[model samples]
Target: MKTILILYYSRHGSVSQMAQYIARGVESVPASEACLRSVPEISEVCEAVADTVPDSGAPYVTLDDLKTCDALALGSPGRFGNMAAPLKYFLEKTSSLWLSGTLMGKPAGVFTSTSSLHGGQESTLLSMMLPLLHHGMIISGLPYTEADLISTQSGGTPYGPSHVSGSDSARPLTDEEKRLCTALGKRLATLAHKL
Candidate 1:
C-alpha cells in the first residue's frame, strides 16, 4: 500500500482532529494508507528537550518518515499568521532530504487551524507550502468544485482545509471543514497513485 504521511503540529486538539479526517480521506482510496505523525513542542529553554514519544496523539515525525511517504499532508496551528514554531523547527532539519531531492515531484497539501475567523488561515497554509514547494513537491489545493467551498460558513479554503477554533481554541471542526479535509487527503493520495 502507498503511504500518505499526514504530518502536523497541533497545539490544540483542533488540528489533530483535522488530521484524522484527512487520514480517513486517504484511507478511502484503494491501496493507500495514512501515516499520522506529529512534531513535539519547542521550549524556550536552550537546553530543554521533548521526549522521544508524546504522551498522546501521533508520534513525533522522523526524516525517514518524510523520505518514504508517497504523499504528504502538512498541517499546523496558526501562530500569528504563520505555522507554529515546532513544525517549522522540524522542517528546518530536512536539509539532507532537500539536497537529495527526496520529496521532489511528490504530491503534497496543507491544512491549518486558527483561533479566530481572520486568524490568517490561508496565510498559514501558504507558509507550510513554502517549504514543500522548495522541496519540489507538487502542491494541491481544493478546487471550487468541492461544493463545500461555497457553502461553508466555517473554515474551508481553496488553499486547503482549515478550522476556526474559538479564542479558547476549543471549537470542534464544522462538518464542512471535515469534508474539505477529507477531500484534500483523497485528492493528494489519488495524485500520488497517478503520479
Candidate 2:
C-alpha cells in the first residue's frame, strides 16, 4: 500500500483541520493510507527540547516518515504568509534525506490556512514547495478543472488547496475549500500510484 504523509503545523487549528480533510481524501483510495504527523513549536533558545509526543493533535514527525512517504500533503498555518517556524525547523533537518534522494520523484502537494483574503496563502504554499522541489519531488496543484477551484470564494487555489480562517482565526472552512482539499489529496495519491 502507498503511504501519503499528511505533515502539518497548525497554530490556530485551521491547518490541522485541513490536514484531516486531506487524510480523508487519501484514505478514499483503495490501496493507499494516510499517516498524519505534526511538528512541534520551535523555541527561540534553539537548545530547548520538546516532548516526544504532543498532548493532542498528531505526533511529532520523524525523518523516517518523511523518507518513506509515497506522497506528501504538506500543511501549515499562515505565519506572515509562510509556514510556521516549527515546520521550517523540522524541514531543515531533512537535509540528510535530500542527500540520499529519498524523496526523489515522489508526488507532493501543499496547503495553508490564512487569516485574510490577501494573507499570503499562495506565497506560503509556493515557499513550502521550494524544498520539496529541491528534493526532486513532483509538485501538484489543484487545477482550475476542479469545479471548486473556479467557484471558491473562500480559499481554494491553483497552487494548492487553502482556507481563509478570518482575522480571529475562527472561520471554518467553506464547503468548496474542504472539497478542494480532498481533491488535492486524491490527486496526489492517484499520481503516486501512476508513478
Candidate 3:
C-alpha cells in the first residue's frame, strides 16, 4: 500500500482533528494508507524537553518518515499567519533531505487551523508550502471541483483545507471543512499513485 504521511503540530487539537479527516480520505483510495505523525511542543523557557514519545496523539515525526512516505499532508495551527514553531523546527532539520532530494517530485498538501476567520488561514497554508516547494515536492490544493469550496462557511480553501476554531480553539470541524480535508487527502493519495 502507498503511505501518505500526515505530519502536523496542533496546540488546541483542532488541527489534529483535521488530520484524522484527511487520513480518512487517504484511506478511501485503494492501495493507499495514512501514516500520522506529530511534532512535540517547543518551550519558550530555555528550550523545553520532551519524552521520546508523546503522552497521547501521534508519535513525533522523524526525518525517516519524510524520506519514505509516498506523499505528504502537512498541517499546523496558524500562528500569526504562519505555521507553529514546532512544525517549523522539524522542517528545519530536513536540510539533509533537501540535499538528497528525497522528497523531490512527491505530492504534498497543506492544512491549517485558525482561531478566527481572518486568522491568516490562507497565508499559513502558503507558509507551510514554502518548505515543500523547496524540497521539490509537487504541491496540491483543493480544486473548485470540490463543491465544498463554494459552500463552506467555516473553513476550506483552494490552497488547502482549513478550520476556524474560534478564540477558545474548541470549535469542531464543520461538515464542509471535513469534506474538503478528505478531498485534499484523496487528491494527494491519488496523485502519489499516479506519479
In candidate 3, what are the lDDT values of residues 1-195, reduced to their tens digit?
899999999888999999999999999999999999999888788667578799999999999999899999999999999999999988998999999999999999999999999999999999999999999999999999999999988899999999999999998999999999999889999999999
Model 2 vs. true fold: TM: 0.98
Regarding TM-score, does 1 or 2 come out ahead?
1
Could you give me the TM-score of model 3 versus the true structure? 0.98
Clashing pairs in 1: none
lDDT by residue (1-195, candidate 2, tens digit) is 999999999989999999988998998988999999999887897646478889999989999998889999999977888888888888898999999999999999999999998999899999899999999999999888899987888898999999999989999999999999999889988988999
Relative to the unseen true structure, what is the Cα RMSD of model 3? 0.8
How many steric overlaps are in each model, in order? 0, 0, 0
Error of 2 at 118 (Å): 0.4
- lDDT (Cα, tens digit) per residue for candidate 1, span 1-195: 889999999887999999999999999999999999999988887735599989999999999999999999999999999999999999999999999999999999999999898999999999999999999999999999999999999899999999999999998889999999999999999999999
lDDT of 3: 0.95
lDDT per model vs. reference? 0.95, 0.92, 0.95
Ranking by TM-score: 1, 3, 2
